[model samples]
Target: MRKNFLHFLIFIFVFCFSSFSKSETCGGADGLVCCNTITSTSGSVCAIPANNKYIFTLRRFGFENSAGEVTWVGTETSFNAALSSVGASMGNFISGQSLPEGTYVAVRPEVKLEMTVNGSGVSTSDSVACTSGGDQTENLATVMNNLSDPIPNCSSSPNEDCNTGDGYMRIRDTQLGNFTVTAATARTINFEFDVGSGVLFTASGGNCAFRSMGPLDVTMSFSN
Candidate 1:
């Protein structure tokens, strides 16, 4: 009788542990989606330029709860930096902050549409190498201003599909589904930026001109 009771207690503990572990899902509409490549039409391609430097400002960062309400973690401050420089530094954005204990499903980041892209890519139109004169800030406010979606739409079927002339821009939001905040512990989010297919090149006046800021591969991770 004592052995049977011990076995029953062990079974109950295992079942409860499994149930609690399964409740925390890390991906979906409520979590992060990392894409390394852009979906493009035929004859249109994306590549990392020789010197690709993407600079933008992060305006706001926060998390969304299951109730569709957002819980902001920090003040509205301009964090201007190059895309390559935002890896481990992302943790600083939420430093010294605590979230209300709840299950969060999404990450919200308000970014300024004005960005600078400096790189050189082989033009799909004529296979010519095109490069930006320097770091020229392009205002993408017309297409991506105040856009909630972080994933950009770069599926336009054209020779310059990834170029601004064709009105192609890549933006997509990162989801963090069902992330529960317990005890308001210190948390950090890590980011990996893959610029392999981040720029599209086109021939302009016998020189390479930036057509548009192509899809940027961004992978995000969270830890306590």
Candidate 2:
């Protein structure tokens, strides 16, 4: 009997130690780190605008299982997430939505491809400055589809273009990291937009006549 009791105690110690180690390695209040970074290479030079705004519509939020199936939750919502040197949040779009008790391998978010970016850029040819006027909304789907097409001039001016009145829309599926949900668990998910090097400026017709979207870094963090 004494030997059996000793073995049980050893098992408990091992279990606790394993759990603690996992928690430490994860390095968050919760045991999961669901962070993802996204980038694009559409521009020659990357920069951060003085006042950058990334606007998009959150069509749906869901979770992916190990078998690559998604279970969706939440309603459609629009978010105008302003990004800066520090980064910005899109708020809790999934609030009040409950997920079934299960382990999810990834997060799937359906968003509109239409996004608006507000920033400034300089032309490398003649050191000319360019602006999107105030904000330029473009369809990423269109841009992606027509990669070889010539970039439209922001204005008719030879030196600078500042038209900024374009809009388009499409839907896209974005998948982030993995997480698990239980009946007793309370989760907090944060969508961080890092635009440190997101704006791009290019020369057109020997002048700073075009301003286009650049690389963007997005991070999604989950905690309790």
Candidate 3:
């Protein structure tokens, strides 16, 4: 009897330990959704997809307005450079062009969108993250900041996406980093942003905008 009871107790301990050790995976509406700026290099929180579909967002670091917030004006142009900066392909990928508007733009039957940004210390910055789980999981491990290709307008709002809540973005699954998004589905994404005045670059602004180019949005997708 004593041996049997000890075995049973050990079994319970193992079972409980396994269950708790498992990282909680989120899905469905409340589970897999959207996210925003994440400053920790330790990796941000993300929803685990159920199947094949995945979604995410990215942005360039810039500052706008006296308060400094993320703006949309330089986003389209800078994201591409961000991708390449992380050592991704640049073939056929062009900036400044909008994703072709249409259906199937959803990319997969189920997708999860995640975006991320770094913090500026003093004041807390903001970010956004969302998931569309039916048969999908948020995979963000593949995403990385593009330090190479430079955006033309970034000089204006250097801290746009990172320092301020302006362009708040988030990473999907904290596991996957740096991902490639095709035009077919990419066109469907509607990125709405605000570009504050007197923050961008010009002949007079000179390198002021360049120094401001700090953080940007990192996007990624996952497979089944």
Candidate 4:
């Protein structure tokens, strides 16, 4: 009986030690999922993305609409871009999710923007083209063109926040494909998920951006 009891105790110790070792591996710097805060803008993280699993669901593109605006963020869903060849690179991460470094075909979507404030406004547009063009506009544009809602009380930067006036915005549906992640000592690809029409925004020639809500904790990474 004493021998049996000793055997059991040894087994327990081995099991406990094994579990601790596994936790230490997963919680290390080269781990999969992380608790680090995903910032409002594109940045780096400690984990690789593809090593994780999904709590999958339909990620339909929709707007937060007025007071629901706080929910717009970049980390909830993943975006895919089809490249013509392996040499393609997405310039400046191409405005969304962390993609493997190399040359990417298209980064920013081609769209027009017209943001008007109390009186002043800005207008810009761009042609849609890739290594091949197939009209990616319907893929992710979240716009509220109706002038029905009462505009909010203005109190912010006119360029970044348009509290009143007619507004229009759209996101090109990202083409889905299997992408190659160039090997690195460490790298990250992130997408700007927070989107909107007339809140805090940035207007260039063909791209319009509002302040992002935030990013989720999952990442998609690949290796050599």
Cα lDDT, all candidates: 0.41, 0.41, 0.20, 0.21
Cα lDDT, model 2, residue 176: 39
Deviating ranges (above 4 Å) for candidate 4: 1-89, 92-143, 147-187, 192-224
Candidates 3 and 4: which is better by TM-score? 3
Ranked by TM-score, top first? 2, 1, 3, 4
Candidates, ranked, lDDT = 1, 2, 4, 3
Task: List candidate 3 stretches off by more than 4 Å.
Answer: 1-50, 60-91, 94-163, 169-224
Measured with C-alpha atoms, the lDDT of residue 19 in candidate 1 is 8
Worst 10-residue lDDT window, candidate 3: 1-10
Q: Which portions of model 1 miss their true places by more than 4 Å? A: 1-45, 50-52, 76-84, 121-128, 141-174, 184-188, 203-207, 222-224
Clashes of each: 18, 0, 59, 24
Predicted candidate 4 versus true structure: per-residue lDDT over 1-224, tens digit per residue: 00000000012111010100011121123332221222213222222111111111122222222222312212223222111110122221122323323333222221223211110122222321101011112111133323243323234422232232222222322232233234432322332211111112233333333321111122112211
lDDT of 2 at 168: 20
lDDT pick, better of 1 and 4: 1
| lDDT, residue 110, candidate 1 | 53
Tell me each candidate's RMSD, in Å, in order: 15.0, 16.3, 22.7, 23.9
The estimated TM-scores of all candidates read: 0.55, 0.56, 0.17, 0.16
- Model 1 scores a C-alpha lDDT of 0.41
